[model samples]
Target chain A: MKAPRRGLAALAPFLWLGVFFAFPFLLVAKLSLSDTALAMPPYAPQIDWSKGLAGLAAFVRALDFETYARLVSDRLYISAYLSSLRFAAIGTGILLIVGYPIAYGMARCPPAARRALVMAVILPFWTSFLIRIYAWIAILKPEGLLNAALRALGLPALDILDTDVAVYVGLVYAYLPFMVLPLYAVLERQDHSLLEAAADLGCGPTEAFWRVTFPLSLPGVGAGALLCFIPMVGEFVIPDLLGGSKTLMLGKTIWTEFFANRDWPAASAVAIVLLATLVIPIVLYQRQQARILEAGR
Target chain B: MKRGPSFFNLASVVLGLAFLYLPIVLPVIYSFNASRLVTVWGGFSTRWYAALFQDEQMLDAVGVTLRVGFVSATLATLLGTFAAVALTRSGRFPGRTLFSGMIYAPLVMPEVILGLSLLLLFVAFGLPRGVWTVTVAHATMTLCYAAVVVQARLVGFDRTLEEAALDLGRTPLQAFLEVTLPNIAPAVAAAWMLAFTLSLDDLVIASFTSGPGSTTLPMRIYSQVRLGVSPEINAVSTLLIGLVATGVIAAYLVQQRRRATA
Candidate 1:
């Protein structure tokens, strides 16, 4: 109950997060500027703490921007960034088309049915995310179930696996719940009387929806879009498992640089660039979320 | 509840539910197929399930996964609850914006960067990448999810109960433990489950942070699926589904019972 103790309690989380979360960014930022080397820890020049702060300053000054310059010169990184944005944008668009109706339908369900419906929606989402994505491989691969079904139906077999289409399918499938849940939360809180009021003012049903319901759900749309888009932009597993070498995703490129080429500094530079691209949407998302939280209270 | 055409809403809900469940159901059904090929259904058999149990690598991965989930989730919940409490109760402070930014950033941070950065940090600290390292990495990541869940619950909470406790001469920590905790227990429990599920399902971060003895179940599954699917994957997926279903139903029943009593 004491003021000093409360301050310390609040300080505890700040300290924990600062050390674990913010400190990593600092390390990555430093690593991003370092040169790749064939030494023990793989990237150089080390902090050289034994030489003290002056030595640290010298090492920091020695760090080059070549890795960053490589990202600009190499068309691969640019295409990868563009391709990631395209996939994520396409994924978000499809999610809106698919998720909007589902959330709206659930919102319109009878109260007794709505709870059960919400539970059902959450059930699959609660299950393993990777397993769900894995399930798609069986349905989309050449010798997979989709082909088998097509053969049963006397139709041509299609090979769409290891393509951007499969990656999009996987992205939309995996992230649909993320889109639906936020949309549902916002839609469920809408006041029905607003629509009735619109009708009373001589507005038609569809007209009333666009004028009132849709506007009211804008926050939900923003929230859902950001939730899906942000992760889709940096998605690694879907592109790796489902997309082709031609797909050109930043996430895959970064992963390959680190794991396959064993170039930590270059990967760090790419990651920082990715962070730069995402910074705007992230700030917007935070503001939108804060608005929603305020509205909730 | 209807605000529009009944047919449209009904069709949309049905289609969405079908799309969600069909993929899950196919895997479950194929998991029991006796045929070697996944597409064909020869007969019902437990052969794959038997094989899954017999596979030593899978067993080892399962052991590592369970340990990581238990340790990481528990730590994440404790720390996250502390964070949630601090965030919700504290009015505002000098560095609140920076603090909140750090808290929320990881929610949308890319897995690759997070993994790489954490790995670098571990390396910097001269820590070995094994079960303990995996535990620390997971706890740090999952704590954000737990904080978000608990924070949502705390937002709608009425502070009067805690105020009354304070008025009755209970210390802040004591009141928080006795009064606020019992009230927010549901959210806290949900946070724990979310944290555990995230840790269990993770592949990318664990791939970066794990060393010799810490190949998780998802990592094992990923490596296997690359080679190609066998009945073994279906069997494992089925087992995971069963586990999740049991937990969900149990939680649902408890919630319903609590609502009834309340």
Candidate 2:
């Protein structure tokens, strides 16, 4: 391609992301630094471009880190952040434990069964995420199906709805496909000869798996864990629908702050902090993707 | 040299699949309940589906969702195709790092952060939040997904086919149209489907960016769910699940056919 054409090709998405993707974060940061006002947009120091550089300077002068300070001082905000991290960490651990075996099973299946099994995992992913989480309510509520089933079986009814356990259930249900697919991809490509060699060396099947297969699948584990963990940290629907009101996830906090509280600056501040926590994972994911793409080439 | 699944492996797979499916299955089963109370099965009936179809608000939300999904998915596919091509084919350009970062970042960015930022941007720009605003937001978010999907196809693409087309005196665009486009059409189509579903599935961003009268299906369902899960919502979920499952199966069959032919 010609230089001008190449430049234009790059420029299209570049300009689009600049305006839509990248610029918005700057606006959020600016909003986060601004003081809340009892005004239309509910924040102050609006840039008056009509007054040119003077207005810009005045706007700059009006900005402060007060919202961040409030976020720090407020136990609610701190707990929300910590709770989000905690849920995500525990959820990731459970998903890994649950997902690894399933993925390993699929990877060991016959080629035909493997394809079918993969589709079984992906079909739910194709379904509406909101609907899937909502579905859990039917099974988890006090007078829900679980209790009905328990009654039929003459067992004690379990009350799990509107609790942390329900949130974990939702988290696990929603993110299991993400965890399984990547692990399966990595596991399916392992060299069978390595296992055969290990067997020849008198290693038990389990021992061979831990020493060979499991080590080989760590990249997939990292990819899957990060994929699930990053989103779970900011997950709104799962927690909102399945979690109790007392649940203090940052995503729900941001929503409540923005929509209910009408604290735009505070919401922006929470969002900024949420983004800050995710920067490392996001960067790591990007690098891993680049490496995968490079290796593909 | 392949070994069959062990008993442990078989058991875990069964239980995991059951866990993954039971929540969805319960709702689908309950959607057919004749009773108003969701827990009670008053025999088989489609009254909820009838109620769902007649509900004007539900129908309106569905209409809005379909329109948003179509428009945003198409826009995302175009921009995302451009992005994938540029990221994979073009060597480098100004602000490439930032550009690539923007492309990949949204894939995992928190929906709350994205939605709030875009809402602030719209507020700053004095643009009214409505269907178009929601559409734009969906396009921006989903384009990254589309890009990643299309990029995977593009990276493994045989560039020499396009090179050969260009060597045959075709213009760059012509070569792309004649050779590269057909090769990547399946991936592009898959990307569009993914983007559409994502747009269709989104609740958080739409909840943030949408104005009055621009409520998407997920938003409508969320509101209803918050009120309480009803038979009508169950019916809606079942229909949506059926629709998506159909699309996925059809695509899989087509892909299988294509692979066989190839």
Q: Which lDDT tens digits does candidate 2 get at residues A66-178?
A: 99999999999999999999999999999999999999988888999988998899878788888888878888889987899899999999989989999999998899999
Off by over 4 Å in 1: A1-3, B1-5
- Best-performing candidate as measured by DockQ: 2
Enumerate residue pairs that collide in model 1: none
**TM-score per candidate:** 0.97, 0.97
What is the Cα-based lDDT of residue B26 in candidate 1? 79
Q: Which ten contiguous residues of candidate 2 chain A have the minimum total lDDT?
A: A3-12
Q: Highest TM-score: which candidate?
A: 2
Per-residue lDDT for A72 in model 2? Answer: 96
User: Where does the lowest 10-residue lDDT sum fall in candidate 2 chain B?
Assistant: B89-98
RMSD of each: 1.6, 1.5
Task: Give interface RMSD (Å), model 1.
Answer: 2.0
TM-score of 2: 0.97
